[model samples]
Target: MRRTRRDPIVTTVLTLLVGALLAGGWWALRSDPAAPAPAPAQAPPAAQREVTAQHSRQADRPVPRTFDRSAHSTTDPSSTWVIVNKSHPITPSQFRPELSIVRGYQVADPAAGPLTRLLDASDRQGLGFKIASAFRSYGYQDSVHKQLVAAQGEAAADRISARPGHSEHQTGLAVDIVTPADGRCDFEPCFAGTPGGRWLAGNAWRFGFVIRYTPENEERTGYSAEPWHLRYVGPALARELRETGAGSLEEYFGVPGGDYPPVP
Candidate 1:
């Protein structure tokens, strides 16, 4: 409808009133920050709804994948994941795994690659890790234990040495690492604080090895902390242990690991 004789003053007043209303609405919106805008009458598309649901499900944060504990044998002596401790012994006491030499140290072939990578990584980081001990035959271990016992007595020997059948070295999955730069700390607890030791403690999980015995876990491991002692359980279990914060294989696996059985 055209108003040919419209009043200019009245039109200006109406324009001002409309402008005032808009300004008031803008201020209201600005001032009420907590108030959400009105929702659309129509629902969002399925894909959009799904996206919103997914985002909202941070309450639905994707569940972390569960690790299969039985992916490898913990009881079989040859199994890469075998748990060897004072409470658990190699069944035959002379069990030997397929061997490979890494830097002149014999280790289970399954461990060779990861151990190699670990060593190489250490070298790259200037850690200069050396293998002080590796696979030991039952007889050798028995002799070693006897020597320690003779030197330091049974109680002291047991703290630092493993009985023949109960030794992880016999499993071919354990390696004693030392740093030539810090040779004085070889097989000593102070090694854990060394540059290489700190690096290995924090990074070895990436290569499937773990600082097997620790002071915090000594009661569970049945030995004093030997940061030099590394047991290969493969990268999978290593990552799981690192993630779950399990300090000892015995604690994680719930296997008995304290003190040797009383002699019959």
Candidate 2:
């Protein structure tokens, strides 16, 4: 035993090689299966929430299909939606609607009941509203326009009276309302401040009527404010006008209405 001793260097080298081998084997065992590739990430629920919010906004908005503007003819004299203005006149210069009497006032057959109801409602409030003028013929309008032009010049007459075919009264849907009890402001601008006028302004739409010419829309209508002049457009259209806040049929329909265009 004393004669067979190993070299210290050899022993040291052998220990180092064995340690290295052990380290390599441990590292291989620990890293071997590649740690089961990480589970794929999932998306947050935000997309579904955004879609629900978008649907709610769409539900709250108003749909344009609720009312159809083309429901009635705007050019036909008999149509409730007919637009008579300086630019668009009644098709035939002498066109007249079939007339009937509403409380002794002549109006279109379709307008009689609504007009009567309007006046009766006024009477209930101790206000007497009379139909001063309704359903004027082409000749009558011509005469009225002529008189106004002669008395006050063409510029002034254009504000108060419409030309023959351009008159809404020719359609039988227009009425000049007045208070018979006092006749103080009949057909005058002062009437707009009267009780009857105020009531009509606020409530005429209930009976399918609208003040055809208004101070707010005089320029577009080619006339001055006429609080007493009402045009029956049927309840549906009247409601639409009120809801949309349209000043005149011309503005509502995107049509020209400042003044009569030159005759071709």
Candidate 3:
């Protein structure tokens, strides 16, 4: 007996079904097993950076050159003028004279209303202090500077004279205290020698005043010791400066010592 031939359609259907099953099994077996998980994304860098104004300003600032103490002449006597070489030059006429009083051929102005009140309070406490000089004109400084130069060499004059606009007097916030004879403007050794000077040195901050130049800060101020000179920087700031004993305003403000004019 002869076997019967199967139908072509049925044979094709069976062959396709088997192939599908084999493909599925092969894919399942070949797939990776126990694969590690992917890592997390990294964070972006910070957008902000820290910078200080002082650091930026330092680049533009002018470094002070070595001064020839012997070569420079003092203020000219024949000419009545004041000129500040540091920062810029300023004339006496530019100063506000309305807020000041004249004493010993120099101007004296209270720093502000609050400071004046404080000064009054100090006076009531038996401090007995008076402002000797304030708000000097460039012309006045020039004439005096020249006289000092004539009397002494440039170095000595620089120790005592402030070039015009650079003076704290131009800011109307500084004063010179009167000594016992007015002739003796001795601002060294110790302010404690006089009652007024002593009281100021102790309590000037209460009235927004500070010794402009101190012995320790001679290099920063570009001048020798001066205990008579007082600068008004407000009670809060003055108190801070006094406590820190940082020497001069330049140092307190982070300015290079050589940039400021000599203490006059």
For candidate 1, which ten residues in a row score worst on lDDT? 46-55
**What stretches of model 2 exceed 4 Å from their correct place?**
1-65, 262-264
Clashes of each: 1, 0, 11
TM-score of each: 0.75, 0.73, 0.54
Candidate 1, TM-score vs. the true structure? 0.75
For model 2, what is the error of residue 175's alpha carbon versus the real structure, in angstroms, after optimal superposition?
0.2
Higher-ranked by lDDT: 1 or 3: 1
Report the lDDT tens digits of candidate 2 across residue range 1-264. Answer: 478778999999999999999999778777888645556586434334334433554586665425556656799999888899998889988887899998777898889999888888888998888788899999999999999999999878976678899999999999998887999899889999999889999999999999988999988988889999999988777877898899889889887888878769
Q: Model 1, residue 244: what's the lDDT?
A: 85
The alpha-carbon deviation from the true structure for residue 68 of candidate 2, after best TM-score superposition, in angstroms, is 0.3
Q: Which ten residues in a row have the lowest lDDT in candidate 2?
A: 44-53
How many pairs of residues collide in model 3?
A: 11
The residue pairs that clash in candidate 1, if any, are 57-60
Rank list by TM-score? 1, 2, 3
Off by over 4 Å in 1: 1-61
Per residue, candidate 1 scores C-alpha lDDT tens digits across 79-139 of 8778988888899778878999999999999899999999988889988889999999999
